[model samples]
Target chain A: MIPPRRRLRRPPSAPWTRRRPLPDRVRRRLPLLLVGVAALALGALAFSGIGDGMVYYRTPTELAGHDAGPAGRLRVGGLVLPHSVRAEGDALRFRLSDGVGTVEVLHRGEVPPVFREGQGAVAEGVLGPGGVFRSDRLMVKHSDEYRAAEPAR
Target chain B: MPHRDTCPHSAVAALAASAALVTGLVLAPADAVQGEAQRLMYVHVPAAWTAYTAFTVTAVSGLAVLARRGTVWDRVGRAAAELGAGMTALAVALGMIWGRPVWGVWWTWDPRLVATLAMLLAFLTCLAVRRWHGDAARGARGAAVAGVAGFAMVPVTHFSVLWWRTLHQPPSVLRPPGDVPVDPPMLAALAAGVLAFTLLGCLVVARRVRALDAAAAAPAEHVSRAALGRAA
Candidate 1:
């Protein structure tokens, strides 16, 4: 005959018998609590300085104030000043302006087919001596406005 | 498969999608500035809009699941999330293709681009959470919470262009009053595209919900059949 099992129970006043610190409802919501904490952290990061970093490129006016350390590659975006685009040998030179300031850009590459004067463009390179931007890559930036292409003049 | 009654919505979606393709490709004129590359906007913008709508549905369904504690809402949320993720991926790819020729680069670290990518990752993580846990209730609840939280990325992505100075342009149609700068024909085509994509998204979500429900019931049916055989 198998021995009868003895029941062991903790005293009512024992620490083990005390209620859990967190209620069952709160315990069940732990995952949600973690998510809330994470979202808060991300929001904090975005608002504090990271938001400023999100600006992909700087305008001519901002670039004027920016002091990129020596040899720092920076991107400057603005409207290409009309009649400022001229080719000299293998290099093309133009001035980018945002109406507040202008930066001279020297690019040595095949310009994009869509690049036009008085249109928005971004150039990526370092600033040379005398405030000239030496760009190796040039990109056109289209505006939000859209219209039918006019017939060839 | 969806029930026979849902076939009418599917048919209408198909017809609208066809109309959108015709109008977007053949009828809409090339942009004055970007020329033919602007044509991609019809599909790209619509895909983005559809993704936003799908994610909104997921977020709402998630709230319903949390409030009601029902499998129906969970299934709907999961299906919408899956559809939203796919549309987001499509929009990103189309944007990249458009970017290469027009923007002169395939990708950039622009705020709008980064925020959109973050939104995609957030929903994908929510979907993954649904499969991570062994307990069905726990997994579903966790996913519901995640789905609700992931919606914060949508507004961030939408407003990133406006709040920051990025290479990406600001809103064209969804802006404040008196600022819709698109051509009339182009706007019409774009409107048609958005409608077609939205209807198609709804049809797909409905079918997916039904499929999920059927799959959830299959194991119980199998168990019942086995029990009956044993009794016999």
Candidate 2:
């Protein structure tokens, strides 16, 4: 015959058997409380530095107004001015415009294949003497607008 | 169990996804500016949209779990979190692949990119919380809370482009009351892709919820069998 079954027992000191300092409902809701607090803290942090967090790149007009100082590196985004691109030995020079102000850029690195006049581009570097923006890196910025290779039938 | 032998939803999802692939890769004309790289948008945008839908489902199901105290809603919240995290990862990877050629860098610290990453992490944390405690009910409760809180990331990520200057472009389709910027053929392809992905995501979530229910039932079945043996 099978032995009679017995319910499992826990020692008095076992964590589950120990007396709880907090009420059951409060203990159950602690995780939710923690999550709420964390979310609020993160929101606070994000909002406190929101100005810097939001602006990914400075436009030509914005950059012109600020004194970034010598040796300060920043990214300037604007449209490549038509007929402003010229080659100087290994480097390429182009004027970036934002319809309000324009900044001449001297990019020393390889120009992206998509880099073309009338298209948006962002250059990362510092301002040099004679009001020229010296760029070490260049990136093409395509607009949200998309068109077929040929006009839609 | 009646539908267990064959899942019609999976089959339909497969067909829809195949049609999307063909239309996106073949029928849609190459972009005038970005060329074939633009095709990545077909998958990238749909994946992001699917992720957003999944997170929203999780958030709603999480609320149900809190109010009703049932395992069904808990399972749904978990399943949705799983799909949301996976789709978020897919969107990010595809965006990186597209960005490498278009933006000249594989990654950047742009607001849109950072917000998307944070959204991915939030859902992943929700999934992890489900398995944190040994007690199923307690774990589900914690995960439900996480699911509700994590949804805050969705709107932040979606609007990051509009709220700030971003390397990423603004919305082409889900914009203000105006004509969509995408060409007709490209728009068709993208719409098809979104439909396919949404169907597929729903199918996966349904299957996952069923599996979780079965797993939850198994231990009770085993206990009953052992008790029957003792009675015999």
**Candidate 1 docking: what grade?**
incorrect
TM-score of chain B of each: 0.93, 0.91
Put down candidate 1 lDDT per residue, A1-153, tens digits, no spaces: 112223345477878556544543454456445645665665565444233444567778876764452456667899999999999789999999999999889998868777989999988788777778889988888888989997423
lDDT score, residue B58, model 1?
A: 88
DockQ of each: 0.22, 0.25
Which residue runs of candidate 2 sit more than 4 Å off their true CA positions? A1-54, A66-71, B1-6, B220-232
DockQ leader = 2
Model 1: runs farther than 4 Å from truth?
A: A1-54, A66-71, A151-153, B220-232
Residue clash pairs of candidate 2: none
B1-232 in candidate 2: lDDT tens per residue?
3245336776888999999999999999999988899899999999999999999999999999889767799988898998999999999999999988877878766688878877987887787676445466777888889899999999999999898777789999987788888898899999999999999898878767766776567654345334323322
RMSD of each: 11.1, 8.5
Candidate 1 lDDT score relative to the true structure: 0.80
Q: Tell me the lDDT of model 2 at B201.
A: 90
| B145 Cα displacement, candidate 2 (Å) | 1.4
